[model samples]
Target: MKYLEWRINGFLEAVNFCRFFDLGYNGNRFTWERCRNTQNWVLERLNRALATRDWQNNFPNAKVFPVESASSDHAGIFLTLGVNVICYAAKPFWFENFWMKEIDIKQAVQTTWEHGKGQPIAEMIKSCVAYLLEWGKNKKQQFKAKLKQAKAQMTRYRNSSNPYHLQSFNSAKEAHLQALEQQNIYWKQRAKQHG
Candidate 1:
């Protein structure tokens, strides 16, 4: 979703999407406040996960936000599937990779040449630009692959019988949910460190 959201912005700058979070585990067992205590911890772990796939680099707006963990010890994760995923667009995000395409990191290097790009630290802009490009490429790749797989799965379901079709539909949904959980495990593990 983050990949999709980033691609969405590629073509349409205004394209934006949001996801809400509970910030806690099973609501019955824990409370949001307890989860709040772990915000720093959770984000610290999440940062590593996001870094693993270079996710944040690609989708600038797509992020994991904390509210009040509420009702559960698990801090809720507000993740917006990036780019086209949130918008659910039929068309793919079309854009060229400028820096890598040219094999020239001049503009990328020159980014810091302009002051105010990173006020606190002039080197910050360099890091941001580098991160953005790295993640952007990966995000684009992920987006295309995900989109293709979804299209294929949908086509298969469309061709099958009613029962199998429904089953396939449900199976696909379950798969997605599982994927989301797996993706979120990075942060989950981070929270566990406190234990």
Candidate 2:
């Protein structure tokens, strides 16, 4: 209870540091619940909609409310700004640094570039980008499939009672760890690029 209070106080301090005000919501008082229906169950208002004074003034009619969710532990917060907003689609192409580690990436880029010979530089770039996006999509799918397979195999081996399964379990576990490491490297690079 003391730790929870400390955390709540720290959160409030951070909010004050940011100079943001909570847009109080209607409906359920608690936003999150854990171990529901049990004696140890817990409920807390862990989420809030915050806004700067300028933002609040700009959208004075904005309303905030919580929508209870049956599928998730936390309720979803909905905000209405009393204004129409247009949303734009995100850029389709982004070069992932992790792609450089793949053996076929260099060859694939070269092939696409060669295929666009005699074309304008912009045309060649567009072609190469289109090819890379398609290739990356396929690569990502394959990587996810492989990782899923590795996890499934590890789980299967782990549940067996036979001593013979130990070696197989170890191999599967190693493969899973390596896959996770590769995924970690990809995300770390992405974070560095975005940050």
Candidate 3:
């Protein structure tokens, strides 16, 4: 129990110090498994990839998977940090379906389209796209700020032993989880990959 508590505390401190989130896994959860009879075997998740928020944002498609290891008791970690970029002869115009879900998307699109009425079709399309891209940039900045604030709040609660703080921490964690889930879904759709 003491060893477990120490490990937990060490993990929490490392997470806070490095401002990282575990990228989770695609295969087995436990990385370490004692080679013994079922009654005596022990399993623990001892390996993982932890990345900072900026890393998570930059490598949105990054995944941590367990690789089969024959030389050791622990499974090897395979961290894939590849970005998919397709080269095209002619640039294709693509609009996100999620843009319609934003509250200000209609106003922004309408205003941009109206202002470019007299311009050529290509120019007008370009103007509207520029406006929408700016809006998306602003939204991303706002989200990052909120995420930072939540992380700080959670860190404070984690260090406190107070029951009230613990309850608040749980709520904060739940909110963070929900936000991450939504983000994962959006990225999965964009990347055309399964979670």
The most accurate candidate by lDDT is 2
**What are the RMSD figures for all models against the true structure?**
21.3, 11.1, 13.8
Compose the digit string of candidate 2's lDDT tens values, residues 1-195. 699999989988998988999899875567887864356778899878999999999999998876544246676788999898787977668787767657798899999999999999999999999999999888777766766787677557754656678777778766666565556667787788779
Report the Cα lDDT for residue 158, model 1: 39
Q: What local distance difference test score does each model get?
A: 0.44, 0.77, 0.71
lDDT of 2 at 188: 81
Clashing pairs for model 3 are: none
* Cα distance off (Å), candidate 1, residue 15: 37
TM-score computed on alpha carbons, candidate 3: 0.45
Off by over 4 Å in 2: 1-87, 159-164
lDDT of 1 by residue, 1-195 (tens): 599888866634332222222222221121132222243422222211122234445665564443222133344445564567455556432223322333344554454445436455746665655555565576546544653464356446733457877677667645544334433443455566546
Q: Put the candidates in lDDT order, highest first.
A: 2, 3, 1
Q: Show where candidate 1 strays beyond 4 Å.
A: 1-120, 170-195
